[model samples]
Target: MPFSHAFHPATDHTRLGKLFYDAVEPASFPAHILRYRNNRAAATVGMDTLTDEEWIDHFGRFTPLPGSLPHPLALRYHGHQFRQYNPDLGDGRGFLFAQLRDDKGRLLDLGTKGSGRTPWSRGGDGRLTLKGGVREILAASMLEALGVETSRALSLIETGENLERHDEPSPTRSAVLVRLSHSHIRIGTFQRLAANAETDAIGQLVAYVLETYYPQLGVPAEGEAALTLFKAVCQNVARVGAQWMAAGFVHGVLNTDNIAITGESFDYGPWRFLPRFDQNFTAAYFDQTGLYSYGRQPGALLWNLARLAECLLEFCSHEALTGALSDFPELYETALDAAWCRRLGVMQENPEADRAFRHAVTLFMETSGIPFHCLPFDWYGGGISAQRALASDRAHFYNDPSFSDARKALEARRPLPGLSLDHPYFAGGVPCNMLITTVEDLWTSLNDRNDWQALDRKLAEIDLMADALGTRESLSD
Candidate 1:
């Protein structure tokens, strides 16, 4: 069925008071419908709250609210699907309610997913499941609290309809996710228009993104201009991975459609944080190949960025885009190292420190053999951050076997995580964190520690300790 009004911009009238008669409708799902109005969170944005009845009036039955207006314009975008170009993709079942400036001057767009069908539905059902909305809310909130930059969930309302979901139990309830984001332009958006030979549209979207999210890029011609945008993207990609690594998060799916051009974590789906270290861990139960394993996050991100670079082929010379792509490795490596340092609370950046950091990572993974979640993984990955890092990966000042050349490199720093290691808030158990277990396991077969994977686990322990110690220091300071 065609939509009643396609891409109609409406300033959620329920924003001020109850959405009286004919404003909302029952959720459109087959499962349990759960309605979560935008009152409480909306208040934070300095918006008014509506009564329960008003909420129902606005969302329960499909009707325009009092203050609602056709959006001044249809949100414009294009992107790739999988690896294919898709030029005609827009809000198939969603619309931008309004654009507002947050306290920090960040342009925040309030968007509704599953409100109804739009010009972009592409002849498919445009519905959202309650469970899916719940998942995204938890994913975004948890990641943000872990210090990852992410989109925020403003509200999730049940439209009083039962939804059929493919991944969950049959006949799930329906819900709507009204999310706030810095930008929604995605890599797929670029690929879609580019594939249609709509260079002009791609340019318009690129310019919009620059003016909206990365005004600093200034939308110059390809070459250094393209490189600048690419560089910005690479930095964001690297930094996002660093944050993910620090917290042991694994994004189950990282398709071109999922990677946000703005660099903020967007489109939360099947995400998990490791409780124990395991390079082969994944979030999706069906990811049998582990194509997006926990350890391969950095590589996957780089690949996604490369796809984005490919989209810019028309605006910039192939050489320019390639040059920008090249920066990804150097930039990602540095950010990776820096993230380890920050997570460990290391005070300096050096190859030696990074090596020890890698070793620490290796140790934790080999010993625990645990999935991405477990008690030990939670503490350090959570905030057991010690502000101190090793002076260098070469800490063997004393000729002690326990403090061997490798151990020396790892433990050469003084003040140890300096002080955070001693704090209770950051401490989980006295010992046996995933990283510690890995190191101790290595100790049992000390010689076997030479194995790359085994050593990686041990290094993970060192890094975890550093994080704990660093966290303890912050409390002390």
Candidate 2:
């Protein structure tokens, strides 16, 4: 099979002695049952060549792949966990396994979770619960279908180990999850360099990022590259934050370390889709202060962007960095409008129409008193026809007076080109959603009967939704 090694021997992160990562090996597990495999993502990188056994060996047993990273690299970094800065945080449970390019030739990283222990394990056992792996698969699938730029859970394997945890049942099952994403670099990656005052290393990292990911930016003047990279990252982060809002996703933990440099969402832990339009909705149980609530996702991401700007300050002037950081709010609002329009399944008419439509949608959601997920389902083809929505369970809510102006705004636009009003999803009265109860119910069947048919069915439904509405990349255009 033809494979492009985008980040291995072709381009190593050349900040030698900066301690950006550490070499680690995966744990030997008793079982290597392939629980899930993403052939859609695999085919993009020519990894579909791997047979089922090869997939298990490579991802489950952690056997080194030919021409891939010879040793797993446990990346080092620091993050502000729950608003408190912690210097001793890094990839304790996983490492980068390989770097390959997708069919579009975009660089992609194959990273692991619950694979094994690393230097950053910090006395805790570096393991992942089987239930955790299952939840991530569902989260990624649902997010992708909803047009959120997110990592795909490429492969999941039951590792056949009993793990004890404070959260879930003790001596529970164990598994390893591998995800495909654009990049594993994080805001915390730059924070470590800034903390060490490693100006030279920071410059080198900036150059690497530009050449590897943002080549379109081209080479800038000597001292200007860092600022340029910071600005681009800020824009990308803002765009992703906007998508999260449009998707009704509360990312639970918005730590700097969880913020992907490529602006793709990954590392799902306690994420939740909103039941309704509540701004205070939070997913993490430990979040006593509601720091990273549903409405605060944008602010949390901006905070992370500021940390990245602080890192660039070592190489660029403070004024330049702040200028880049200041662009986030406006950039986020613009991106949010675009994303919301895409989710609404309509072409953005103009700046005024776009702004008005977005506001109308928000107002409708705030006052509708319906489950948040219903809007996307009932209006699958852009809410162009209120008659169709009225036929379903949403009829009473759609009749509410507050939705009058919102329905008018949607009626002004035609259906998004190429979307069929007759898609089967539109006819299905119940919209597909990954609510907490639904996810737990799916797991319950698995736990009781060791049956995975329901999980498989949910994925099929999600794929159909993605095809009907289009992925994030397709809709944005």
Candidate 3:
């Protein structure tokens, strides 16, 4: 295969040594049927030219990428699952398959889901239901289009296996998913080292993360390096949490393992986009207490970051680490305000004005019982689209007396410079949404009749939405 000039392979993770992960083999599948390929993501790493056969071989068969990891590595880590510390947690059914640099020379990892069993499998079948894979693809696509910092679902291939899952009907189809992410090193990675009292390993991991992910910070004094990295990670994670809030997403699981040190959202299990503004809404059926609910995500993330800080305590003082953690609320508030402005396509004013606007928008949405997507879709350009929005079918909801504050807020802000409202996506009757019902229907069409039209059409609509939102352009920057 001809790898493009932009394709730069690196085995940087290996530098962390065997103590952080274990070499593993991918399971040999009965069949390799390609389901989805993220050509855009592939293009970033210069693999978009691969034929279907080659794509299947590399992603499904787990063939090593040229100049990348020769074999898979099931990473070692421990995480707090729903506030309960679980020492046995790790990559139970996934592995870091390959690592390479994108066009901008940033490291990226090709990680697998349901590729095989490993020491962490714990007697469970190391397989992903086809329905689960479909959900993840949709989740990633929708989140990315909405300008959320998330992993890209690189490739999904049916693996011709019958799997029994409690969550779904028996004898369901199986698949393997490959996701492209900035990094797979999780807070749990550091937790594992801390748990074992491997202070030296923790220091090594801290140095590796700084050099690989935060090189801009440069070499800090030995005492300040860990604190510096913690602060950066805090900022990144806070931005992610704020983005989720702006997108009205509920990540059902906020486990330490799922919270990547890089702050990129990945491992979409039981995720949901809000149909309406409901703070108590949760995606996972198992979340009885709503620990990671839509309204509480910011707090949940801060809690997880504290866990990461605990691991870094060996290198930094408690007061310094706590102060770094203290920055999360302000950082999240700032990011959330900016994210809302971006989504609304309005120019941001002072912090007080921005905060008031956001609060007004939230108050109206919660009290009016309007669909979550409708508000942003209707008022995308703020006051600039007021006439268009009021003329639409959803205008009745906007006319309510409760909308007065939000209306005033919108009228006070100007549309972002060069933000055109003429995009066909805005003119459409309905906005692109990923409600649970829509997802289930899409899956049903594919599973019962092998009809991919609905799924394909939805993806195309999502792309149009992205174009209108300028999320694709923002991501490129």
Candidate 4:
């Protein structure tokens, strides 16, 4: 690889000793068949020079890349799983494999899932099903296309193994997956240190987070560092929650361990795109209580931020911590307005007007029975093309009187400057969404006949949509 040494695997965790992580090795597999690779994400890290063989060796066989970690580290952390504090929680099937800098000079981590078992493996095998890998690829791709900050699956390898599972069919295929993200440090990391009353360790971790992940925050005055970090984290988490809500995404599980410190969405286990504007839509079959439902996501995230604040109480005054927590709702509302405006393809000139237009759009979608994901696909590029949207097969029920006010309000807002109303994405009628049924159908084609045409086409379509919307580019430009 051209930038092999672009990786600098330094284990600061070793300084924290066995309290934060366990040394582990990857599981040996029968075969290493490449199933997927994300070249776009690779380009960001200058890893595009890796040959197919080397990619397999480093990512599939789990060999430590040169100048990277000598051994995998299974991070230790206790988290609130489904609101129940579980002290035994940590990385069981996954471990931090390597660390590298990206094109922007930001540090990134390469983490593995289904690598093998560590001390935290509890009772189950530390492996991932092939279907799970496929689902994650789709979820990450779609989320990225929708302009959400999310972890990308760098590589997925079908490790030759016949795995038996209860949720999925018995004797399903197995796989190993590698993910690339800004940071793997989670909210639960602080929770664990706080739980052990390791105030010094928490302070050290806080400094590390500032330097490595939240560098823009700079070094705060000594006494106020923890409070400043908490406020910044709260704002980021609020922004993420807003993004998920605006995108109509349900994360399935909102465990503290699943909440990354950098606020990037990852660990897509049972995620789902909304089929309608139902507030109670849940992705996980076991979430019968609707705890992490679509409407409750913002609430769940705010709750997690409060927990993170609790972890910082020892370093900061109680008043400061509570003050930071108090900002979540307002920050989330502001973030939601901005996110909704971006999705609707309009200029956010007036905050009141933006809010009114967004509310009207929501009412229209709810009354017209349109799927929430259709908002961007239909209104993308900034103008309401009711006729064009109505032409789509999915828009058969979009003729309700409730849309009158929304349509008029939408007409009043200007399209984002320079974006064509007739962009290819908008012209295509409806945008593609990875709803559960669609995902299952794509997987069925692969599992039944080893066909990948549908998946390939869908990815291409998503890429085109991203280009049309300038998803990765600055919207202000």
lDDT of 4 by residue, 1-477 (tens): 445444444454455566678889899999999988888788777677788888899999987877767889999998999999998988899999988777677778899999988899998699999999999999888888787888998999999999989998989999999999888889999999999999998998888888788888887997888888888888888988888888888999999999998888999999999998888899899998999999899999989988998998888888888887888898998888888888777788777777787788887777676777886666554445656666777555555566678767776777777777566766666677788899999999988988877778888988887777676776212
Sorted on TM-score, best first, the list reads: 3, 2, 4, 1
Candidate 2 residue lDDT tens string, 1-477: 433332222225423443678878888898988999998778777777678988888899878767667778888888878778888888899998877766666778889999888889888788889899999999999988888888999999998999999987788899999999888888888888888887777787888888888988988988789888888888888988898898899999999999988788999999999989899999999998899999999999988888888788768898888888888899999999988888878888777778888999888898776888888677755656567888888888878888899878887776778877677777677788889999899998887789888889989988877777877457334
Error of 3 at 419 (Å): 1.3
For each candidate, what TM-score against the reference? 0.69, 0.96, 0.99, 0.96
Each model's C-alpha lDDT?
0.56, 0.83, 0.92, 0.83
Give the Å error, residue 393, model 2: 0.7
How would you encode candidate 3's per-residue C-alpha lDDT over 1-477 as one tens digit per residue? 556667788899999999999999999999998989999899999999888998998999988998999889999999999999999988889999999999888999999999999999989788998888889999999999999999999999999999988887989999999999999999999999999999999999999999999888999985899999999999999998988988999999999999999899999999999999999999999999999999999999999999999999879999999999888999999999999998888999999999999999988998898999888988987998899889888999988888999999997889888888889998786889999999989998999999877778889999999988989778768
TM-score of 1: 0.69
Clash pairs, model 2 backbone: none
Candidate 4 residue 148 Cα shift, in angstroms, is: 0.5
Error of 1 at 392 (Å): 28
Q: What clash count does candidate 1 reach?
A: 76
Worst 10-residue lDDT window, candidate 1:
16-25
Q: Give the TM-score of candidate 2.
A: 0.96
Candidate 1 lDDT by residue in tens digits, 1-477? 111222222342223222110222223443323334434335534443455554444443433443344332234455544444456666666665555554445566666677766556787566776656756665665555445667777666665566676776657656778777766667776666666677776566666566667876665665345556667878887887777776677888777767777777877666766656777888778777787788888777888888888778887788877777777777767766665555443444477667566565445444635343332222242222222112212212222243244333334433223344444434444332332243235434422333434433433443455444443224222
